[model samples]
Target: MKYSSILFAAALVFLAAGAAAAKVPAGLDRIEHIVVIYLENRSFDNLYALFPGADGPSARTRWAPQQDRTGKVYDLLPPVPDQRFPAALINAPFLIDQYVPQDAKTPDLVHRFYQNQLQINGGRNDRFAAWSDAGGLVMGFYDGRTTKLWAYAKKYTLADHFFQGAFGGSFLNHFWLVCACTPKYDDAPEAIRAKLDDQGQLISDGAITPDGFAVNTIQSRFQPHAASVTDEARLLPPVDLPTIGDSLSDKGISWAWYSGGWDDALAGKPAPSFQFHHQPFAYFSRYGDGSDERRLHLKDEAELYAAIAANRLPAVSFYKPLGIENQHPGYANITNGDNRAADLIDKIMQSRSWKSTLVIVTYDENGGFWDHVPPPKGDRWGPGTRVPALFISPFARKGYVDHTPYDTTSILKLIELRFKLKPLGSRDARAKAPLGALMLESK
Candidate 1:
């Protein structure tokens, strides 16, 4: 009895010590600005497969053979429908630049909610080519070392294990970035709900689920948006849920969602390349047109640069480039977007706030690309396919590749921890913060 009592006390002491050691590192508090550059779809493997020191594919690695819907493994991958790629490619990851150079645009792959789940194939990650609209193009990747972003990665910290917070595409993942929860369309029409087979495989694609979750790309009902009043039945209603923007506002901290071509979109003269669904917060009631939140928080990309130049950037900033410069497949080529990103980083570095600022560059989702690393098992929404993320700050470890597993919600976690704000939802509350990259040393 005496020995047992002593052992219990020692265990308690050990746990207490661990708790103390887990406290937020002091250096994180020094960051005055948190800038999130949310780029368009590109998976870790899509852009960073050849990156040194990353868990990237190598010549010796064996890729999982793709299986068709009936479960037959393909000996040769299906031909890329547009004939942009070779017709007789084998069933494995290939260096895309060898055939279709990075400067040329490629056909966009199917990246909808149901299709993504189907392609993941219960985490085997072997059905991407079978389910992809772009066929074997899904298995293609670039030699990232040749890209401009790779140069910045070599000088900063690259997070090799980070994933998108949600499955599917930009619209849903953008919401996850702010709220860490799926948006709801509670009274959605039956016609819009996804039709699933008995095996839970998608028979037809949909913007909303049977139970009312908005999983696929859907237009917002607000003005300056793509949807009109006549399209109300299909559009997403004003979301009433709290977002990271709301939390920041409550504390009187400055923040903004800066998107390219915002001013033109509002004037009904939007650029041909402007995307409506990319503006996630515009769907919220608090940020309706003419509302103070809308006027003050939603601005043009030019404003972001002006703020940076003037050294009065907001405490939190989200910059979404125009579709033409966003690096999305089909619409934009990789080289143009790569140059734009490098330019943004150079401008940010010129700011006086650069010393105390942390810039996180990440993609919305994998864009239906094939990645060898299976995402960690998460909830129905996700911590989806691995996406390349980087930390560019003076405090970031120079030339380091951080392998800590994180998702889109990790951005929220970092914001909440630095400002002592409450988490917007369960996902962010439980998410592991990106302190491994932000902190000065191992915690």
Candidate 2:
């Protein structure tokens, strides 16, 4: 058959399958509120490798071997450097479950955009240690048995095949979660542009090398507070990107991005633990500091708690925890973050809106952790690595594991479908909604 005919056949098969799978469960329309609680940096295998029924790492599973910059496999993984820990004390790809206590912290690895591509290495997935600043620690895994969220997975719907929308750290993936598009800076100052080497890695000194990928971390030019002086170049300038919020508002639907420490951070308070880049809406002109949109939609996480108590939750909500509550390596540990998230869930369950709400719990990125499964083919930004996602609702299928191919944009797709809103006209336009086999009642 001609190539065009083959494509047409595939399209037909896809449409038929979708029609078969798409079921508007009874009472789905009664779900008036959708809450998305986005956590920080963890791969699915890193957190849910032993999840009861999810596709996670196993002893029988073939491990992706670590590769060196020279394309040679490491006989033994190297210790993460630039830390107080002795080189001999640490080894790459070690069972973190054995060493790090459930409450103890681990070193943060490099999960930057370019470095992740190097680690992915055209899907060989063997260069994690070679390209990461945290060395073999990049290959670490955890015991899900000790985590609270793991228990929650057994109670709700866990999606094992979900991936991060973009191939980068919290900064970019957060953008993908809210906007389903990468933030761009036109005419960026030469001083702040990522300097790259011939190998497409960011050069030691921050300049764009010829024909090299600008994958290194750069500072945002437009930070929330001018007094903050750390990693200024890492910030991206404010862009008028279209976001899910924009879409909802355009249709007169109510929504909010409730971020931890947002109010304190905007006030320039010290140690609010607010990450500027993590707040994607702040970068958009529509939600600038003094705008009515900012006041109405960009809210503190406390507001969400209050809304839950008052039974005034909006049609859509996205909640981001503060640094200490976010389950990020190096600065924070898994146990505390898991417990915090569980507490939030417990509160939601007790709230008045629980019966009419659908809660989605997921991470922003893999946080430089290793996973055995490769992400599906996607556009330039990503479908980076597998991350755990949970669908929690009164109507959600109990004790279920969803294997649908989804990414961060999938959340946006769900919101679009739920609100009958137009697409964001990016990857979200084509992203699959995680609605299959999740609801209790079927057509």
Candidate 3:
């Protein structure tokens, strides 16, 4: 059965019409394909406050709601307690050791790992530089459904509201986006030391065990990418549950991943490429076919830019840049990496395949940025974090801003519904379908 499935998929690719990639097929469940464009940091108030244009469902682009119905802006009482404004708290398991604000660079896990810790070297840490004064580190970012890349809001849709699922660092947020699940949200240490890929190689077994791989079964596959690089790995759940790639295969849909560098395929946690889900680690192991047929691993990040114009795009696509450009703490420039990422999405939008697809733009987490709305922890889909989310489609409502609460899981839920595939598990089956607001009635 699996062999026939493979043959069926190959047949579809051979016969897929080039020009047909631009239109959403009739009776296609919901969105036929989705592209998740997750960014680094920043929130809704910071980006949209100065953005002079059409916004929100109400068609107003005014600053935050710290105002009265009578045009009076009021300061929040008991004011939002955010560390990014005045000072951040140094929690335990942070900064290794703390030195009272010295002019020397030492190992500080709190400053590097904690999102709320805004200890910049050689300088002043302005709230505007880290986040906006309107809302503290928790303020979710709102995106212009239009003009993400010089495009018009009337032409696309903006999330206007989104938040991360966790309170710590980048690794956990990135993990959630991929798996729709994770066991350790912020349980791992800041300065993680691993027997696997942290500085070595990962060990794996077929079971979905938490520590990534069973220590006993971790034999050297000898292939450079064979094992993981982190021993501090957390187990991701619902293993048998279908991933997005699994659904694409069931529908005979094709997909591709163009990653940044050596660890571009999301390996090396406790290290740089910490964001990806755990499954990819086992997907193309040298223990299998030993052929790099499934994904495109690039040492050069620029190589992916050209695929934006390719006509035979897989039904689903995910791209993550490499190194300092991806906004790692070691080389962060605080320029709002999303601005550059937004530019990339803009480039992809002008392609020949814009009309038939949906692109979800959001952040993995706040990167210690702020949003006033505390993350909602409903019995199911979330307690989701708040970050700005953007939904872009040709059929998307112009100047629309959905007030509905959404998070990373909403994206997966939308895809599962639209594709008519089985949900990933309990999390997706019952999670709210926020994407329903983005689709046109005719669609």
Candidate 4:
């Protein structure tokens, strides 16, 4: 009895001591600045699955039966259909064989749909009859993968178990990432309201139409802007409901968003938010106001040093990339390993800003990739399907691989918790709380 009692006491002491040794991650400090650089779609393993045992607790998890079986749209197949891909290296059957996955390792319609994103990746392959393995595993035609992100993983913190909120495609998931909720599908106005039911839940369904908000409407708009301003014309309506932007602004902290230029066409994805950040960046460029709320812009990471050297660092700054760096498979740079996304993140870490700054790096969605987790929330869009979340700052614990399930709202939640600020909206306010492991008790 005495020995067991002694062991328990020792364990408690060790636990307390370990917690004392760890410091809070920089993002959760007074956390003056917050910058989220969302990359294109990708899951942790698909990108880092090859991380050579770098896979986390959830890596082994794969697709299987779930209540999600109700979402199958393949049953409504038409006799003839559009070409499966804008460009594919193999015939539909073979392409599906290579990419579209099946349950129990068999050949069937279900497997094909699961393999290449049938509904979300939309298209019919009734005509093209040829199988070519020129490209690689995924369709023979789409050949793009990069080594940059892996290199970045070597340098910074990588959150392996982070997840996307729910199922479906990028549209609703990205909306939730930004606003924490998709306002009743396609509610036209694209607004977020404050309301809670008995559940105190904020996430809603992806029902956009003339009656529901279509995926394109939410996914494309980059500017709270209009066509007259720059490229792709469709602008994301300005969100007044608080975001990480409002959180930092409230603390008299400075923040900036740096984006690679996109005129307008691609506003829905990473493009729109980049422009919104630039609106503030334009303010600092013209007025040269270096006080609180100073925002700036740059097309690439090359200019970051001068800005940091000039001591023009904002409390939080977001770096958006263009061209080869964005990591879109469409960019066709992946296999060749030109991870402009990974390198830019590495570059930011090399800066003096990294010391006190908490860099929140993640992707907008899985970008038609596959992950094993059945997302924990709504059926609309979600927690972007388990991409990696990297935290690189003085406060970040080295070699810390956390398995905590976090989503976009966790970003807002942590900031609000750290600063004693109000939650951004219903989803974040009511969603499950973020793991407090990143935080250290203030002295």
lDDT values for all models: 0.85, 0.75, 0.42, 0.43
lDDT of 4 by residue, 1-443 (tens): 00113322443354344321123344456445555676655556456654533552242543331112234332222221224323333221122323422111211111111222222222221111111111212212121123545544555456776775433344444445544544333234434222223443323322232233333323223223344545332323333333455555656665555556543412334443343322322212121223333323322344454566665666656665653444444443343223555555556566666555666777655544444443444323434356767775555545556556677677756655655655545446545444432443341
Model 2 CA lDDT for position 386: 87
Which one wins on TM-score? 1
TM-scores, each model vs. reference = 0.93, 0.87, 0.57, 0.58
Better of 2 and 4 by TM-score: 2
Q: Which candidate is the best by lDDT?
A: 1
> Of the pair 1 and 3, which is ahead by lDDT?
1
lDDT, model 1: 0.85
Q: Write the residue-wise lDDT of candidate 1 on 1-443 in tens digits.
A: 00113322443354344322124557777888999998888989999988889988787766578989889999899889877688988998899888888888989988977778778887888999888988898989998777778988899899999999988998999999887767879799887888767666567778987667888988888877763436678888999877899989999999999999999999988898898989989989999978999999999999999999999899999999999899999898899888888888899898899988999999999998998888888777888888999999987878989999999999998998887777666667678998888655432
**Model 1 error, position 412 (Å):** 0.6
Q: Give the lowest summed-lDDT range of ten residues in model 1.
A: 1-10
lDDT per residue as tens, model 3, 119-204: 11111212212322323223223332233332433356656555554333444444445444433222333233222334222232
| Alpha-carbon RMSD, each predicted model | 7.5, 5.8, 13.2, 13.1
Ten-residue segment with the worst summed lDDT in candidate 4?
104-113
Quote the positional error of residue 165 for candidate 2 in Å: 0.3
